[model samples]
Target: MNDITPADSAERRRRVARAIQRRMVAHVAAGGTTDFASGPLENDPAAYTDPARAELERREIFLKVPLVAGLSRAVPRPGDSLLFEEFGQSIVIVRGRDGVLRAFLNMCTHRGTKLVRAGADGTCERRGRMTCPFHAWTFELDGSLVGVPGRQGFEGIDMSRRNLIQVPVAEWNGIVFVRAAAGSDELDIPAYLGAFAPELAQLELADAAPIRSSSLAADCNWKCALDTYGEGYHFATLHASTIGVSHYGNVAVFDDFGPHWRINFPDRRVKALVGLPESEWPEADYGGVHFLFPNTVVVVGSGGPGGAFVRMFRIFPGQTPGTMSCRIEVYALRGVRADGDRAGEFAQDDAESDVTREDYRVAVDGYANLVSAPAGFTVVYGRNELALQSLHRHIARAIGVPL
Candidate 1:
């Protein structure tokens, strides 16, 4: 898929509007029957509890797959860099002076020391150089080792071969993705996105900028944390005090875009769109929750005090099998009051924290009970939870596990 032009972008918006209209009409006619999968699905408990299975997933799913590392705005300028760990691999994403975004293993060439230890993300003002703190070994943003201290001590060493190891990196619609494993230069991000590419492109994420970001360490398996956003079945019960007032209960429209899925939840105000034409329909009428295969969820909702905003939840495997880390970034549309504004950004974070904290609490409790349950314990996915089933099935296929 190609980047959406202005005409294509407007047409895509209309397409989404019409699709939402059709779903709303069908929903009203059906008296609130939710979209469903072929049948209920069961997941093996070992997928979440077994260390051996976790290791397999780390290889096949996390390392082999193209994982979203950060947003384009994270390194918007040529000298900016972001560092983070994914599945035990520390990665550095830097923008070169030539305006190219590249990713490398965040290790020193001399003694395997980390090149950037300031924090998760920072800006490099040395123009084209990344200096290792240990020995002051310098490298260009393109991963070329340009300066090495005590060069005479290593007479036969080839600086070209000692440059930082370059990993597979690609950017699609302002989202940066990297393959952490070595020799993974052939991963095609667009092909990995499949049918979901166009829809993501329609969001015009490249034009939107991040206003605020935060990370949380959760006490649950990575899949468990991801499962929280795959379904709306718990909205009324789990989020009753938070977001339940605005959304309907257990009602959603589901679409499978290849291995990924999109779930649209009609809020209480959706009924107002019954008589409006597609052109008059607003995109904010429906809450769009998209699962970008493997480990990301993009939620589009009202911007609370401003306009609409997109919240991206990038989930990663923690140090242990039963833990996970999540980085949430909030991006506002252009010309919105919240765009690049600190106070508006704080409001977005506060709103997200309210709902997310509730979800994480439930996940932690559920994981505890799941692991302690009797042998052969399994988790059942209701037909309404089709996205959740799709996620597990994709992971199973990737790791050579049976359904």
Candidate 2:
């Protein structure tokens, strides 16, 4: 073996030391009780929804933060890939023979061709290899440019020099996340996950099959759509038809872990959570909302020692100023079923039709009015908007965009 340089040895030792220190801190923290507090988000016009300002903010958060790109699983095994678009970049994620997940920009190197024409639903084709219909430039699942039709015309062209551009990607929590930034290594996914990584690991999302998946586009600024989901205060008024069973404004708890925050809506189980007076309250109602930074929201319903169910929200920004898209997924413990489907599964089916329809109608109406408001902008975020503020602040800091 080559001699190890002293600097390299020192660097290795430092990394090991940090890992040990992190574990020790985690052990001590785990031994103690935990508390969650809500953080404040200011109404910053420059960051929230301004077309010019939002563009700069989005670039930093989506392109600079090596967040979701490092922790989501593309494919759990070999020969699998997922194609999607985000942040004005077409992305293709694939699992190589080594079982490593990799991401690439979907643009073809030659003549600026789009390597993968999106399928009907605007997702990956999922076939073995992707073929560009424009000139039939074929790329393997690993993103190597394998063939160029009619190669005789371009003699001495180095095929190896023409491989597809690769994007940064990492896998954690059974989800695949891609970052459009170039020259970025695998992000420290677990650290960005903060206190929730361990809790998330227990879910075994890689094994959890998605019963259904749907995407919705709303005529609202992306932040507006995200804001709508961050708080439960709207449940009583906005979601009255669907979430009426759940009481709001009764008891709430908030917790922050630097960039991450969790806003817990008092579940009916605890006496304090009982909405009515102690005399009229019953036991056994429970739920909470866990908001992750950079646009991933998970709502959890209390089960017992473990979680009962969770609904996932993945928000994507549209190229236009006032357009946004969202993906919703619901998962539950294995073998748990309700009305022939998994307990949380039914809610997911209704997400697009009922839940999303309600949210969409409100979002479109809300943004249209905000943009058209005579006074220009008058926005209100009640105390229940605490988590929304927290999210905004985290996003602001990550993107260097103030709001």
Candidate 3:
């Protein structure tokens, strides 16, 4: 195979989009046919309820690996900063004056106080330096300690030792990744992504811009909430009035790249291609539901009344199995849409509504049964629910657990 290069990336995207479109079109023509596994997979319910398992996942999957912080556009400028908080830990990611991306503990060396606060717009705006709210200790954008209010009080201490504590950070294909645990290994994005790097590069996310966002706390295992995104099997019932009205139910095309995968369920609109020539087939706005291993769901699709948008959900484990927090951010590719575009707004709003109001409500109620159910109880993923089944398999391998 020839090496994938930047020049051919756009062509690759066109090819990927067309291939997915063909798969979706064919499935729709076949009356909602979808890929299926050879047999049903019985997954342990305790995987979601076991405190030990949850903690193990927290360390093995989330903390041990790099976590998606935000888009590179978040801190585009030299002095720009972003505060990333998850699992009770906060990290400050910034670009130095020299244009290098850097991340550090969001702490003041003097007293461990948070160093920066977001402005009214929810972005870290600073001059050339950051000042701690507690002791007024100042640090440069690159995390260098630049000043101390009480210099004479600590004259004997080495100023260099008092700089902000740095953490692991890397930028790739427009995504910003950071490791909250200082003891974790340094980031090697290419090795971390493996074959998925070329696929991500094709998206050209480096130029995508956020249009709108929302965050929510839910009562359920993070995996449970995540499983909801893996299939359209529930669209006909759970989302009958929302997503079901547009997308076909129980129809999807699944492609796996290592632990990462993309699943696409045809929308009713694709039926237009049923009798049309391949040359007349319309391009797919929503390429597919893309899952970046561990925890992030990214889908590039239409916003309904809004237009083209990229919707992302970053799910984080709460302190226990019964709790999880989610952050949803919708972005628009440059020139494809504008800031304050209703398409992006509607997409984010409708998505947040569908996930929180509908799916999460069911998860909350059903999880109760899971907690009280008998020890032999197991959750079954039918042959048709391959995406969800695959997710469980990936999680098992990542955390060294047998599913």
Candidate 4:
């Protein structure tokens, strides 16, 4: 395979540079709400690289935020339930018989054992109770410890008064959220979602069930993994072999919403977006990318609504100073009408998923090299780095660390 010459890179890089300049200038000229010059957490270096500092954040910031422990997706039916771990706490998300979404700590009150193991499907034996396998401790779907294996073991044990710990949880825009600490106050999920709420509310994501799910552990910083996504700046070179012609938009249009951020761009291959002049670019059919506070990133469009043809979610973690685990969720719009009949939704979804996996492989390799350096320094983030900066600042503010 022929490598891209310096001249080819220069030409494409120049185009991307000019696009970013224009977008930034226009955003400021229009009096956009974000202040990119100096954000609240712009200079906090400890939050990103310090393990001890990150631990404090893991306790107060991540646990109480309501963003980390929420229900990401759910089915409205009563039997539907989901489980995930967040901020070192195991969370159980279930829909009660009244079809209310409830979240509880997945722990058995006896011996302080974790009731459910990881990767197990959700189940509730009673209308509101889930059974513990270790000691056969049965808990209500709502977390009430209604049954114990032996009544004779404890003469005065009050099962009625001994219920499984319930955590504060709220579901909004089809995603469920939880607060791990006991006696923690409820969070306004809608407000916490900030600007992304409008678009999310329109998605109706709960109507869709996860058809397939996969996770991968990588030896790289969580932010490093997430930063590799969003911008198309590296596409032409990094993905030259497989995805050279499918999409376009090497430019990134970054918009900040307090701690949340959104990045939008037009795929050059999409005739709906590419045919128009750069200034008149259609925002309606163009692709959109959104980051939910800290760890969730979704790419939509180039396919249709919910990107009927495309949808990908990235869940990454700060496993260590330099290692991260990322889980990618890919879903294709099933039984949805498309504006165009050019490609099948499932085929397009699979193709997009492949591209993402390829990107992950390359990024992890790059991260390994960076962390191995003897004298570590800051990595330079150019105009394409706005989304990352936005995320970093948000994390700093949330942690109450100086930015």
RMSD of each: 2.5, 9.4, 2.6, 9.8
Candidate 4: residue 196 lDDT (0-100)? 63
> Against the true structure, what is each candidate's TM-score?
0.92, 0.76, 0.93, 0.77
CA lDDT, candidate 3, residue 15:
85
Superior by lDDT: candidate 2 or candidate 3: 3
Candidates 2 and 4 compared by TM-score, better number: 4
Which digits, one per residue and each the tens of the lDDT, describe model 3 over residues 1-403? 2255656876887788888888888888888799888899998898888899998898888887778888987777888888888654788888899988888899899979887777766777746888888988999887888888869999888887888888898888789988778756789888888887777777767777776667888889998888888888999999888788878999888888877888988878889899899988765564678888888888877555545567788999999899999888877754345445764567556755665578888877777789888989999998888888888998898889999
Which ten-residue region of model 4 has the weakest summed lDDT? Answer: 32-41
> For model 4, how does the per-residue alpha-carbon lDDT over 1-403 read when each residue is reduced to its tens digit?
1144435533543454456445644543344322243422233333445677557666756676765432244445674666666345677777777767677677778777777654433332333457777888887666777788887897787767678777777776556667767667876877787666655554444443444556677666676677767566676677775455554435546766777776765334334433346577433342357677767776655454344433545454555665666555544433345435334555666676677777778767766666454453555554555777777666666666755
Rank ordering of all candidates by TM-score, starting from the highest: 3, 1, 4, 2
Candidate 2 residue-wise lDDT, 199-229, digit = tens: 4454444545444456778878777778766
lDDT (0 to 1) per candidate: 0.79, 0.60, 0.81, 0.59
Candidate 3 Cα outliers beyond 4 Å, as residue runs: 1-7, 303-307, 335-348
Count of backbone clashes, every candidate in sequence: 0, 12, 1, 13
Best by lDDT: 3
**How does candidate 3 score on lDDT?**
0.81
lDDT pick, better of 2 and 4? 2
